[model samples]
Target: MSRTTKLATIASASAAAALALAVTATPALAWTAGNFTATLNGTMTIDAGVSASCTSSTLKGTIASDGTLSITSATVDGCGVTVTPKALPWSGKLDNGVATINGFAMDAIGCTYGGNLTGGFTGTDLPVTATFANQTVNRTSGLFCPASATITAKYDFAAS
Candidate 1:
C-alpha cells in the first residue's frame, strides 16, 4: 500500500475504536434505597403567625426501598398556647407525602376554659416522619359559652 493509504487505514481504525469505547462507557440507570436518617424542618404557624410559632425541628425515622416509611418516636417543641381549653388527643395519617390530622388540642393555662378544636396540615415526609407547616386551627366552645378562636400548632410523632 502507498504511504497515504496506510495512514488512512490507521485513522479509520482509530475512529472505530473511539466509537466502540464511547458506546461501552455509557452509564446505566440505577435505583437504590436502604436505611437512611432524614430530618425535615419547617414552620407550623397558626392564623398566619398570631397564635403559634415553631422552628426547623428534627425528625428521625426510616425509609424503605418501596417508600414504605414508619417513625417510632418524634418530638417537636415550639408550641405556643393562646386560650384556656381542655387538651384533646392529637392523631393523624400520612398519605403519599401529606399529613392529615383530625385535631390537636392546647390550653393557654388561664385564658378561656375548655373548648374543642379542628385543623389541617401541610408538610413533607420522606417515607418517615412527617414535619408539617402552616397548620390552621379553629376552637369553638360548648353550646352555653359559644366562644371560638383560631391558632397554630406544632407536634411530634412516633410513626410506625
Candidate 2:
C-alpha cells in the first residue's frame, strides 16, 4: 500500500478507538425519572428556637437522568403551625452524593423564609436517605421572624 494511504487508515482507526473509549467512559446516573415520595425520618426544625415535630410531610417530584429534581408539590403536615410552600415548582439536583434544593421558599408561623438547602444523600438502591443538617434559611419577611434559621431533618425517598 502507498505510504499516504497507510497513514490515513491508521488515523481513521485511532479516531474510532477514541470515540469508543469516550462512550464507554460516560458515567451512569444514580437516579432516574419516576414517582418518588419522601417521608420525614424525624423532627423538622424551623429557625433557631422553634422546633416542629411534624406528623407527616409529603414531597412530590421527579428526578431526571441528568440529576435534576423537578418538585411539583410539597407539604409539611401536622406541625400545628401552618407550613405552606411558596413556589409551586421547586428545582433541585442530586449529584456526587450531594443533594441540593434551589430557591426553597416557605411560609410558616407568620413568617417567610427562602433559600437553598444542600445536604448529603446515600443509597444506590431503593429508599435513598437525604440528611440535611443545619441547613440555613434566611428570613424574607415578618419582623418577628428570625434572621436566620438552621434546619435539620432526615428524609427517606422511595419510588411510589
Candidate 3:
C-alpha cells in the first residue's frame, strides 16, 4: 500500500480499538433519591453531679442522589414535659454509608428546647439493620443551656 493508504488504515484501526474499550468499561453506580425510614434509638445522659437519665427519640429523612437528606420528624417524650421540633423534615447527605447530616432539629421531651445533631454510620443494608455511633447532639434548651449526647442509632429497614 502507499504511505497515505497505510497511515489511513492504521488510524481507522486505532479508532475502532478505542471505541471497543470505551464500550467495555464498567459504569459508576449512582445513588437514587428514595424514601427511607429509620428508627433513631439511643441514650442521653446528664452529668449533674450524679448522672441523670434522659429519654431519647428519633428523626427520619429522605436521601437523594446528590447527597441531600432531611429529617421528617422527631419524638422526645419521657420527662414531665414534651419537646419536639415543629419542622417535620430535616436535610442531610449520604455518601458510602456515611452521612454528613444538616438541618437536624432535636427537641428534648422534658425541656423547652431543640438543637442540631451530627453522627456517623456503619453502612446501609436495605431491609437489614445498621448502627450509628459518635453522635453529637447540640441542645438549645435555656434551662439545660446546651448539651451533647453520645448516641448510637439502630435502624431496621422494612423489606422492599
Most accurate candidate by TM-score: 2
Better of 1 and 2 by TM-score: 2
Summarize candidate 1's per-residue lDDT along 109-142 as a digit string, tens digits: 3333223223333334323344434343443334
The worst-scoring run of ten residues by lDDT in candidate 2 lies at 46-55
Residues 2-91 of candidate 2: C-alpha lDDT, one tens digit per residue:
999999999999999999999989677666567777888877776647677667677778877666787887888787788898876888
> Which regions of candidate 1 are displaced past 4 Å?
1-40, 48-51, 56-88, 109-133, 141-160
Q: How accurate is candidate 1 locally (lDDT)?
A: 0.42
Candidate 1: the clashing residue pairs are: 46-152, 71-159, 72-158, 83-108, 84-113
Quote the positional error of residue 89 for candidate 1 in Å. Answer: 3.6
Candidate 3: pairs in clash: 69-91, 69-92, 70-90, 70-91, 71-90, 72-88
After superposition, which runs of candidate 3 have C-alpha atoms over 4 Å from their true positions? 1-14, 40-61, 76-87, 109-130, 144-147, 157-160
Candidate 1 C-alpha RMSD relative to the actual structure: 11.0
| lDDT of the candidates, in the order given | 0.42, 0.80, 0.52
lDDT (10s digit) by residue, model 3, range 1-160: 9999999999999999999999998765345556666653444443322333336555555656564666675565553444455655666655566555455454444443223444445544333344555455554454645454444345443222
Cα lDDT of model 3 overall? Answer: 0.52
Clashing pairs in model 2? none
Models sorted by lDDT, best on top:
2, 3, 1
TM-score of each model, in listed order: 0.35, 0.78, 0.58
